[model samples]
Target: MWAELKKGAAVAVWFMFLTLPIMVVKVNPIEQTVVWRWANLVWLGAAVFVLTVVGRYCSRHRTELSAFWPDAHPLLAHPQLKRFLLIVLALLATLFPLFFSSYQINIMTTALMYAVLGLGLNIVVGLAGLLDLGYVAFYAVGAYSYALLNYHFGLGFWAALPIGGLLAAIFGVLLGFPVLRLRGDYLAIVTLGFGEIIRLILENWNDFSFGPSGIAGIPRPGLFGLTLSVDDAIMYIYYLVLLLGLITIFVVNRLRDSRIGRAWIALREDEIACQAMGIDKTKTKLTAFALGASWAGMVGVLFAAKTTFVNPASFTFLESAIILSIVVLGGMGSTVGVVIGALVFILLPEYLRAFADYRMLLFGAIMVGVMVFRPQGIIGNPRRRSYPLPMAAADQEVGHE
Candidate 1:
């Protein structure tokens, strides 16, 4: 205990010194003045010390804790209780917009959009085991598809939605073909490069993409050609995103239980074993990429419609990192976890505007803590299927034994 306390104190002191220039000292370059906020240093040291000690304790007792709890929640294991909780959550979601302001609804709508993106990426990174750092390139494809179609041909949001997804899927397939043999770091680098290439094209090609100025005054999604007021539009979009999120959940759940999904998982576990087991690696990879990209593309179209604008800057590498973080921070293969992760990540930052300067610092700290303590993620374990042998087969095996 003494050694642990001493180590924690050392870590805290180290962190305080490392962050002194930024957290404790503020410089006014214009006036050539320096302001020292010593209190921040104290708070930082205290926080780091507590977190280090707590983290070490948890690490040491993790096995014992796991043995005691066994399940994440005992009540959650009961079907009836699970059903009731789901119903209650559904009610709350349905009534959310009625109780909150448009700003809140808008923020939730963005969260739902990210939830869809996380689920889509989950297909590739979580299921297929592909490390795609350029996932945002497909997102940009979808956004640009709608913006350009609408700009050049007066195409509406409804018409461009599917088209954007299709275009993004094509881009996904194109990307998949080149990296078919690549794996691990090589694949990540290629995907990252692909993303940068798309962004650079959009940035430099003014005649094609309107350059950095972007396309604006894009129309919002319509409801059977009926016009809506600003508030009504916000509410409408919220509902639309809610519906889309539901559909995505259903589809991803089904896919996770399907043959293709199993194949993807097998591939993720071992490519050689997957191929040896008669799974076609090429087709499996292409489908994973295509399907994942399609979802991103569709969400991109919605993003364009919701904001009424599209630009290259909006689909940067940071966006890809955020989406990837959502998948990782949530249980990668768990649909419900991804949705929860998106809500926490998107909404928490919005509410923490007052601590904007410390937001990234806090985010990094939380990520490190989670990685060290619960690498499996918030909802780590996904459901697995069991196959039971027939009585005759069991008897035959027993007799042979």
Candidate 2:
């Protein structure tokens, strides 16, 4: 016990020292003053100490505690309970805007957009085992598609929606062709470079992408050509995103159960084995890329319509990381888990504005904890099917044969 306490204290002290500059010292350049937030240091140290102790305890007894984990809870395993919870959640979502303020609705709309993006990336990374760090390029394609089309041709949201997705799908195919033979870290680096290249082109091409100032004042979605008030518009976008999220969930779920989806999973597990089984590797990979990119593009259109603006800065590597994190933090290949992960990741940060300065720190810590304790994610993917056999009968049949 004393050894554990000592270790925890050491960790707490190290963290406190590491965070000293950010959490303890505040310097005002204009006023030429430096203030010491010693209280923050104390709080940080205490919190870290407690967390360290708890983490150590959990690690030591992980096997014993496995049965008590959220995913393993007997109540959560009940089919009827699952249905009841899902129905209740649906009802709450439908009535959300009615009770919540527009600000909250807007936040939820953004979260839904990300949820869709996560689901799209799940198709590639989770199902097909493709590490696409340049996923945001497709998102940028979608947003910019809508923005540029509206700017140049007076195209509206509805028309640009499909166009954006189609354009992104083409881009996905283009990207897919080049990276067909790449895998692992090589694939990640190439995708990262691809994303940066897209951003650079947008930033440097002044004539084409408005030179980083970005095109603004893009109109929101219209309802029969009627203009809505700001609050009404927020609510409208929320519902639109809600509907889109539902559609994405349904499509992804179907894809998960399809032959192609199984092929993708097989490819993810063992590419050579998948080929041995007569699966067309090239076609399967390209399909995953194209489908994933299409969803990002569509959500990109939604993002632009909601924000009423588009710029190169908004679609960065950080955005890709966040989307990818959603997939990791939620169970990869689990649609419901991805949605829950998105809401927790996006909404918790918004509500915890008081800890704005420590946001990234907290995020990193939580990710580390999850990786260590729940590598399968907050809601790991459950086995969808099982084959049962009667061993005695099988043995008798074999004996008779």
In model 2, the runs with Cα more than 4 Å from the true position are 10-48, 70-72, 384-401
lDDT (10s digit) by residue, model 2, range 1-401: 89999999999999999999998999999999999999999999999999899988987886698867656457877999999998999999999999999999999999999999999999999889899999999999999999999999999999999999999999999999999999868999999999999999999999999968998999999999898999999999999999999999999999988999999988997899899999999999999999999999999998999999999999899899888888888977788889988998899889988876676676677667677657668777664223224775598469644
- Candidate 2's TM-score reads 0.88
Q: By summed lDDT, which 10 consecutive residues of candidate 2 come out lowest?
A: 383-392
- Badly placed stretches (over 4 Å) of model 1 are 20-39, 67-72, 384-401
Pairs clashing within candidate 1: none
What is candidate 1's lDDT per residue for 286-347, written digit by digit as tens? 99999999999999999998999888899899899888888888867878879988998899
RMSD in angstroms between candidate 1 and the native structure over all alpha carbons: 6.0
Q: Give the distance in Å from residue 24's predicted Cα in candidate 2 to where it truly belongs.
A: 6.7
Ten residues in sequence with the least summed lDDT for candidate 1:
380-389
| Model 1 local distance difference test score | 0.88
Query: Model 2 residue 140 lDDT?
Result: 98
What is the TM-score (0 to 1) of candidate 1?
Answer: 0.89
